[model samples]
Target: MQAFIKEPSKHSHAPDPDRLHIIRLKNEIKLRGTSSAEAPSTILFDVLRSTPLTAAFGLPTNDALLQTISRERPAIQLDHHVRLPLILRQTDRGESFILYEVDSMVIFTCDKNLSGLVFVPVGDVLKAYSSLVNDFDDEDYLLLDYFERV
Candidate 1:
């Protein structure tokens, strides 16, 4: 059997370094699997501790963050009345997903569903994950297509 190799398109732009970092982090989390004993929230806390953006984001490496995340059911609000619950893990697919809400109404959502990192800007109010996913064509959002190949 031959191992197939895929390459990026010649016309496609180069990947962003920061976005690449985020993708790598997400991949690591997926591979390890996030359980109570090995949750990505803990790993993310550690990563943010060493990251330069830590001071700006004020991400504390503590259980409070995790508690806040768990206090409410994970859901993405698309509009004033529409909200969709998100699964933390897809057991059948062996995929671990996580979402972090950062300052300035920015949200970091990583999942094998999209096979990469997705940054959504909610701007003071929450919105639907699908709304941003639908705007993948827009240039304003930061979307790193780490798994897509040509």
Candidate 2:
């Protein structure tokens, strides 16, 4: 009788550790590339950096802000479940500003890159936008700019 030889399996059922490592590295690289291109980190970093609004506008700590939000939840006008970031443009001068609302306080950055942070109570959001524009306006800027959430 001839001896029969068993053939080797074409594929392994178990995952290869090296292959898994390669996949992880590829995912990390893709994430890093996109993050740098969109530069969303600036906003995220600023959000953390400006915690408690950094008291830049005499605002209370994050805990205190949350308390205030709960207290004034009824009056606050938020269309969405969460207040998204906003980009406001000056009507007259054509300057742009970015806004992020944390609880009842709104954080403002004069430039999109978020070079500086300024904040105001949610109630004064519109006025805050106008104030920034007026700061650079050659003439008195009577017109107000509206918030366009991004």
Candidate 3:
């Protein structure tokens, strides 16, 4: 496995080690990696770092601004049934009448490769491409852009 350098610690402001932002939450407050149940850390890391969603928006999100999903549940049974929606929004306009936000951004890098800075909320990304005809028949971006800018 290749070594990836971690970004400068930004969670230093938080005095509690458990409160550190190792990974932004997704639904039930999952860290970027997995829990004690997961046996292989390598596979867990790959699934997160390689996902196109991360590639586009970058994973282990930046310290400056992070898209928070939510907190984890202490109860395993209750957590198992819960599902959170991922919403993505794009504010930038480009040549492509219809642009999939994921295609525009690159994965986040701890090693200082800021290749792509764009990120999309999971729900929005799915919604934008859900219709998928490829032509900008209607203004899909009407309300979407605001989610990213503000």
Candidate 4:
């Protein structure tokens, strides 16, 4: 009789930890049947606080602003065929701004007046969401150029 010992494979196909986290988040959202679950806010805050944009650009997190955000669920909008859940708020300076989640990881902030857009990536956020918008094809050249500059 011959006995054979099986060795473990050198290649592992496990998903990346960040990707796994996103998958779990999506599952949780699906299970809840609405994106308004506790997960979205928690995930949003987690991403916001950790992003370099917040630290470097002085992203507002004051209690009043946060309270306004928590007061109501954001309205989802379809822009250029992309569905984006947006929280529209008036800044302290009376400027209208929109904060929308991108790719379930990063949040993109845009000025309602088409001033500029800021891309804030959460921890290990992916760029896969760009494909959904088709690179903002419906936007004007100046706006597209502004995005390119950002």
**TM-scores for every candidate against the unseen true structure:** 0.24, 0.18, 0.16, 0.20
Candidate 2 on 1-150: residue-level lDDT in tens?
A: 999998769865765445544344334434543444333334333343534332334433545433433443233343475554232323224554534556777664445324214667889877776656645444433332222332
Q: lDDT tens string, model 1, 1-150?
A: 999898887789765556555545444444443333455476556655554552433433446545543443233345443322344323334444434443334333435435323565567223444454564544424442431221
Misplaced by over 4 Å in model 4 are: 1-34, 39-41, 53-57, 74-150
Leading candidate by lDDT:
4
Model 1 score (lDDT): 0.45
Deviation (Å) of 38 in candidate 4: 0.9
Candidate 2 regions with alpha-carbon error over 4 angstroms: 1-77, 82-96, 112-135, 140-150
User: Could you tally the backbone clashes for each prediction?
Assistant: 3, 0, 13, 0
Candidate 3 structure quality by residue, lDDT tens digits, 8-50: 6855653533322233323122453234343233434444453
lDDT of 4 by residue, 1-150 (tens): 999998768976764445544444334434433445464456455544544442433333444334444544445565684644233344545544445545455443446434223454665233533543354435445664565668
So what's the TM-score on candidate 1? 0.24
Candidate 1 deviant stretches above 4 angstroms:
1-11, 34-36, 50-150
TM-score of candidate 3 relative to the true fold: 0.16
Whole-model lDDT per candidate: 0.45, 0.44, 0.36, 0.46
Clashing pairs in 4: none
Q: How far off is residue 111 in model 3, in Å?
A: 43
Candidate 1 lDDT for residue 117? 38
